[model samples]
Target: MILNQSVIVDIKDIIDKAKDKAIRLVDHQRTIMYWHIGKRIFEEEQEGKDRADYGNYLTKFIAEQLEPEYGSGFSKRQVELIRQFYRTFPIANTVYSQLSWSQYKLLIRLDNQDKRDFYVAETIKNNWTVRQLERQIHSNLWERLLMSNERESVLAIARNEKHMSDAKEIIKDPIYLEFLGLHREASYYEKDMEQAIITHLHDFLLELGNGFAFIARQKRLHIEGDEFFIDLVFYNRLLRCFVIVEIKTTKLTHQDIGQLQMYVNYYDRYEKKDFENPTIGILLCAEKNNAVVKISLPENNKTIIASEYKLYLPTEQQLIAEMKKEIEKHDYEMELPTS
Candidate 1:
């Protein structure tokens, strides 16, 4: 007897899910096995005073025996990594079951415990793939977050210890768009960049931070018989607000901020519900003067943000310089007297 099409489809889905679960289980077991191996090596070293020689000898002997039975997985380098993994996470419970051995390998290399903890929390929260986690690490995402927020606040958000109330906590400056596949040297229009962003909206959302959902593009608004078009629009679930983005390919001017401010005001007044937070306006420009941005908006303005965008990934030195500039700006703001 022939089965119904729906039944066949359901069976296929079940089989696929089962296979995925099995793969995950095997991966978790492999990670646990490596941790146990590392623990045994550590235990062996406890009896010897010279840990250096003891570790070397232990790994070498293990590799000599295990390589004959297993394969390259039991090589001396692999054994050393396993030992380091155990050393990094001494407690078995700290080894997250959701993460694969490859992800753990990357986490073990980080010397800073806070940074490692942040990544662990984010990896679990976002369900990020190993490649995505590696990319975030390479992009210096943690350092970028620290540029605008305190270390503890950033970690708190990542760990779900605190709710995200401000966009500044998640929004990054000099937003990286290398995944858009646009050449830095090539001259492009704002529309072109917007199109590129929509084309790779998934990666853009990853770069935009968590809880962002794309809404509309070139959203039309008629105010007093005048037509205005918002370049891009988004809603941030965490912030509970509508996000208006205006793309400017050239250096930002005061007029750009005024236009964006108008859009934000329009959204807050007309588009937003009473329960929703104030709409946020973001000027995504190629270059922006911080002083100009500050002077254009009110001192207490929290709805408008001027963020620079880069077509390429920034170097470590560049990110450091950016962080220094942000700190200096923050200090300057702090020194100003309140009215």
Candidate 2:
């Protein structure tokens, strides 16, 4: 993927497109082979209606004959799995090329269509590897997201149908930083954590959710005679805005919120173009006081968000405890009387 000189960029683009198409062609052919095998098995079953309801027996018989010639992949169970694959994804064109057979195997096993579609769409949209997809499924990503948001939001994200309107739509709180391999107990400087995140930037971006494109790190800001650096800068394609992030390995304070707000204002006025939306500032911290966050921002504030990040994934009980705390906060907010 070497970049050619500006004048010859088209050659590189052409080759890349060709390579992508070749891969797609191979994927399509392999998918077609499986579908054809499933179709043959199904058609054979249809003709055996007059025979004893020995479809399983016949399957074994077929496997016996084919296993010798076609190898172990033709085992009765593998044949059934192939048949199930075709049954699950009946339409050939609807089968996505972005997913490999391994991914499809995972998809086909899920009996629920909505759940299956969610994973399929997310895998394609996120460019998730088979292992990543497996992890997401195991983590119950859909269920966890649904805990915080409306079902529509979960569905929209899974279907790639959601249009992000604000920072909250695209930004995730308590983002997993396990990919950094940092120990939560270890005391490390902010630079060490930031550098680790930068090193695993791609995974961090995926955990951040969709549409975030990294711009710069420690982006310098000059205001009056003072110079300050924001921890991270990214442009969100979906929100059409610059997002400035500040990292704190301590619980967030009111002063921290104010600092991030200042950074957001700086980017909005100095860096953002007139066509771009207002810049968003996210304070990623070890912990945050949600009440402090609510009071620090103006009513109807959309630009500044305080989110917690975790170095290690919490256990299911721990996650439940956290969600319960959030729900309690929301309940408290609803209980407050309006002026």
Candidate 3:
């Protein structure tokens, strides 16, 4: 006999809850077991502190005793990592039930405490899966974001406690689009870039930073007898404002800035609610002239920003060089006298 629609909905809810509870239960038990293993290893090390390679030998012996019965999960390397995990997070009270063993394994590998703390907090706040966490770590998301702000700001973002009073908080300069698989030497059309971004919208939104939700793509506007098409549009819940993004494959120009300014003005006047903050506009191009941007906007401008986008991920050295240039430009802009 077929069930009614209401019965089917109830059955789905039951299945979802059961699946979630199973995952939580398994993760909690696994985490506690690993922590206990770590504690045991630590106590042994303390008792035989004089032995130089005692810890290694002890872990190997423990693995040999357990692996034959319990399998590879109790291997020497795994046990060592568990020992490090326990050392790093000494207090059992600090462990949360939501994190799985996979997350803890990655957290244990992070050498810097502050960076480790940031990743832990961000992983929980964002509800990132192991795969997402790995990608963020590989991309050096923390360092890339920290490159734009002071140390305190990084903590605020990781904690999801940031109060964004300006557009700068959400705007990342030299945005990385390495996942697009586009080559730096090859030129592409604006629409091509737009299509690629849409195809990888999930990664794009993550790269765009937190609180961004897609609104429209190539949004059209009809005013009087004229027509206009905006390349991309997004809404940032944290900013409580509409964000307009325009893509350019070539170097930025004063005219490009002017066009973006018009779009921002339109969004603020037409799209945004009375209680919302002012709209923000971003010009994403292959190259941007700071001089042109400075000259194009009004003196008190805070709503429009122009930033470059990289087609590929930069090396550590390349990231440093790029960040240095941006910092120098910001300093130069600051030192200029007011008109």
In the order shown, what is each candidate's alpha-carbon RMSD? 2.0, 4.5, 2.6
lDDT of 2 by residue, 1-339 (tens): 886587578878999999988977887788778888887777888888678866777778888989999898888888788888877887878777798888888888786777787788889888898888886776556555655677677678668677767667657776778889999888998899899999999888877877889999998888999999999999888889998889999989999998999998888778899889999998989988887899999989989988888877678788788788878988998999999
- TM match of model 2 to true structure: 0.80
Best by lDDT: 1
Candidate 3: worst-modelled 10 consecutive residues by lDDT? 142-151
Candidate 3 residue-wise lDDT at 271: 88
Q: Would you list the C-alpha lDDT of every candidate in the order shown? A: 0.92, 0.83, 0.86
Question: What's the TM-score of every candidate structure?
Answer: 0.94, 0.80, 0.90
How many clashing residue pairs are found in candidate 1? 0
lDDT of 3 by residue, 7-118 (tens): 8899999999999999889988989989998998999999999989999899999999998999998888888888888999999986878688898888888878888888
Regions of model 2 farther than 4 Å from truth: 1-20, 39-62, 109-112, 135-141, 157-162, 314-339
- Given candidate 3, what's the lDDT at residue 11? 91
> How well is each residue in 1-339 modelled by candidate 1, as lDDT tens digits?
976899889999999999989999999999999999999989988887455687788889999999989999989999999999999999999988899999999999987999999999999999999988998888888988888889999999999999988889999986888898989899888889999999999889898998999999999999999999999999999999999999999999999999999999999889999999999999999999888998999999898999988888888788778778878989998999999
Model 2: how far is 322 from its true place, Å? 5.4
User: If candidate 2 were superposed on the true structure by all CA atoms, what would the RMSD be?
Assistant: 4.5
